[model samples]
Target: MLFFFFYLFFFKLSAQTNLKGKIYFDNEPKSNVTVYLNNTTTGTITNKNGEFNLEVKNGVYQLIISHIGFQTIKYNFDTSTYTKPLVFSLLEEEFVLDEVIINGKENNDEWEYSFSVFFREFIGTSEFSKFCTIQNPDVLFFEFDSENNILTAEAIEPLHIKNEALGYDIFYDLKHFSIEKKFTKYLGYSYFKELKGNKNKQKKWRKNRLKAYNGSQVHFYKSIIKNSSKKEGFVINQFVRKKNNDRPSQEELSKARKELSKSNVALNFSRKIDKPKNSIDSALVILKKAKLPKYIDYLYKSEIASSDIIHKENNQTYLQFDNNLRITYLREKEEKGYILRNPFSKPRKAFLQASNIIPLAEKFIIYPKGILANPLDVLYEEYWSYEKFAHSLPLDYEPNNDD
Candidate 1:
């Protein structure tokens, strides 16, 4: 595994260029600032002069600069066009006092519940999440807005996360985290440093990483770029929601209810409906007959046949599609063994669905290096979106050569 990682690192560096930068705050050079590419392990720290240099591969990357007592900043740049030294000025964060106070007992209870929710959402719920620990949970502060049904969290300092499953200690400078009933979004900067492990432990991690990579979006993207999607056990199909036109009109519903009331036969074999006792009962019966099956059928038939649209321009490849896509990985399953496991593995539905279809705008172009320059180009729905930190791999990660 170490050899594989080394090979990848060297290969990437060979095709990379240098990005030098300095950090400043209030027109003064800031020392000891940590600078990194978001979602990748490539990073460096500012020296006494607040200057650092990084060798980055050809892709669009979010450059994150963070330090203690200052607001972290993320700047998106494409290596193809950004050939100048990057200068970042970070603002100092103002300290604010909490207006609301909670009693000791209440505070403890609320903190416990909120922390559990945040931990689950942040680290994820896979087997990896079980072993991942927040070494400094005390640095975290949580707030819940009951009226808006939103939960927010921030950190006083960088979160030290120990991922036993993947064998890495991640220094995560969490800028913001929020969770609502329908959606979860968080933005932060992270630096992943390898954890020392014995030979057996390293072997286990390698095996698990392979399992996680197999049917993942990263693998899918790479496969698509390589024109080997089918070879990689991925089956793609275009999906479209069925138009709902099965709703019964008021007159039809009224007629059906009257017929049901007059009939001697039962709605089901066990229970006979001689007559509805009230208008409410009559309406219930009518709705049960008119709505349930049609709704179910619509859901079942929502998917339509389609294929991924691939095109190339200026040596860069792009995927284009008009509707929702049903992505099926024949070899991937809801298993606990994969290191980079899917959070939505045990989905109720048979196939994974990616919806909220949108095209890749100029800002979201893909680089020839097989990285999504802008990951936020298309918003995923259902299972695809449920996949969070547990399924994430650094952009520099590559599957084992044997796999």
Candidate 2:
């Protein structure tokens, strides 16, 4: 029996399967880099020859490659073809810092033109973009005219537009309509925000204030240890633990008020964490890195949409925009009806369901119509032509995965 068990165990272990790969820099093997498999605990580091071996069961994996100076590379794992050893080549990013700083600037620029004009312009733009900017268009009208045998209509884009020229229209004749004046005005507004000195100061003050409040509250709880009154001290201790559990205790509320009166992280962290023991020091490190949640940003359903114009169309010209001038409106409308589906809602959610899930990386997918599957299938068509024109990164993409 012992001999048979040993044979079975060895067979199972060998069948577990091992993946091997080498990391190269400039065609020479490198070492000490971290290789991560996405959403899974499996990862490894390269040896002297830039080689790594990973044990994986049968499944797909996204192999993430990251190192000190190279831009990260992620590749999809294909279990069907395990014969060739995996090799990764990372490109040196000449302007990584520039890219990071410019991301928000570029993001805001996307609507600088359209938002400047009629906010309802996204009717010809992106549906997702329209959803974000406005709750509804000012007008949504479609009419058929027997006199000219034509469809006539107009609707504003659903974002708060600063100027008029920024928005566009796709007419039946394949002519693209964009207003120049409104777009320049919107760009001017962006420039105005960038030049404001007080804006940066205000942001810094708020950050410091939040940090100060968190630290002071933690400190106020520790103050109970010094109070000698047994009953009161016990009560305070209970309050401290309760605050950490359900809500902020009385002592924490008091400290929170104190923190609101000041705006200095350096001073508050120092005073609140006076006499740094090991535990306090570690706590301070965590507080420094923690970020406030989106809920704290006052996210509530807006009574109105943020789009440029809020117009409604009363005629049938809208269909003409969809069918004939699809290419002209391509750059202006990238994400038409593609939303991050809520995964917890039983439809098998995508990462984009929550507003907080920003795209950290992306890959382009190519496919013909009607082949890809759910959520992925819906977004594939949107990305086909406007991949380069839009500034944001794609969160999920699957080609030929549609049913």
Candidate 3:
């Protein structure tokens, strides 16, 4: 029998609406405030007068305004309703000691465990994470609520992260990070600055960047826009899971019990316990297989589906689907060859799932210029979810054309 190990693997802007804004703290103009659209590099620091302007296309964006001493603020801005320069008033943050002493000796273990968990989730588990280091881990404060089963983390200062894999120095202003039983979520603003490298290092970085881009969400979106998803090794299949209403009746159970009794009788009469034991094992296997389909109905099977790409006017593309979508990116021939030599190797095939059945609103959207922006836009449930900051690239990063 061939043992098949199924493994799950895992934006841009355009055009001409000016978003002018002023940031204030306690009714005083706050200069040097970093203002930017979340998940994109399009941003600017406030001038001496606390004024800044950004030109963006008509779309929905999460605007982040952050300063050193005050609390960071995020606002959802729609360009359609934006008319004039926006004014933001940020309040000062008050630091107070907790009376309950949550960080006592009893909770030290819990805190350490939570920190480890946070590091793994936030930095990721990929090879990239091996080279990524958090310079100011001491700035993070962790809390756990046993009643809610939530692990929360906050940072007093911007996290200094040095990524040797992608060659970037990142300053991340983490607002919140939480891990519940089923979900892990975090919200933060990051500023990525490229590291200076020699010619050979630059070449290596470009090669690595292209490797990261392939089989990524950005690559998938671009392939969809170009109507070349299949050509790009992407397989879109409809995932169907049906409710199994056919359960074993009482009569069936009684019959099964009677058969077992008969087998026992045969074993005693023949005075051969070993043969009957094998018979009983075979019978159990058959019975288990018979009832398996009913109890294990959640196992999804893929069905053939038509193309999901929909091209609209003005260069807009949509991946329209009703039920859940199972996307698979097949490995290249070279990658498969490498895997053949090493059976324990990680599979190059990448899988991701996007469902409309999520409890929250749909997070994915396709922009007019074929740029897909929004962290919440797609809930990557499989191997892609394992990709965190270590696998992340800047918004302005473009893969090398030669690749």
Scored by lDDT, the top model is 1
Q: Write down the TM-score of every candidate.
A: 0.73, 0.25, 0.67
Question: Taking the tens digit of each residue's C-alpha lDDT, what string does model 1 give over 181-284?
Answer: 75566666667776789999887777766766677666766777777877777676665555445666668788767766786654553344568785545655
TM-score-based ranking, best first?
1, 3, 2
Model 1 earns a TM-score of: 0.73
Per-residue lDDT tens digits of candidate 2, residues 1-403? 0000000000001244578888888888989877755423356789998998888654444566766456656577655567778888766744222343234235555323333333332222333233223323232222223455432222222122211111211111111222232111010000000112365654643443232222121121122222221221111110000112333444654555455446443434544554555544544434533332212222223221112111224521111011111111111221323332223334432221111111112311211111111112111112221121111111111111211
Candidate 3 residues lying further than 4 Å off, grouped into runs, are 1-12, 16-20, 53-60, 76-86, 94-109, 242-306, 309-318, 331-364, 368-378, 400-403
Best prediction by TM-score: 1
Give the Å shift of residue 178 in candidate 2: 24
For 339-362, candidate 3 gives per-residue lDDT tens digits of 343376566663232222121233
Off by over 4 Å in 1: 1-14, 26-28, 78-86, 95-106, 243-277, 283-307, 313-316, 336-364, 368-371, 401-403
- Ranking according to lDDT, highest score first: 1, 3, 2
The global C-alpha lDDT for each of the candidates, from Candidate 1 onward, is: 0.64, 0.32, 0.62
For candidate 3, the 10 contiguous residues with the lowest summed lDDT are: 1-10
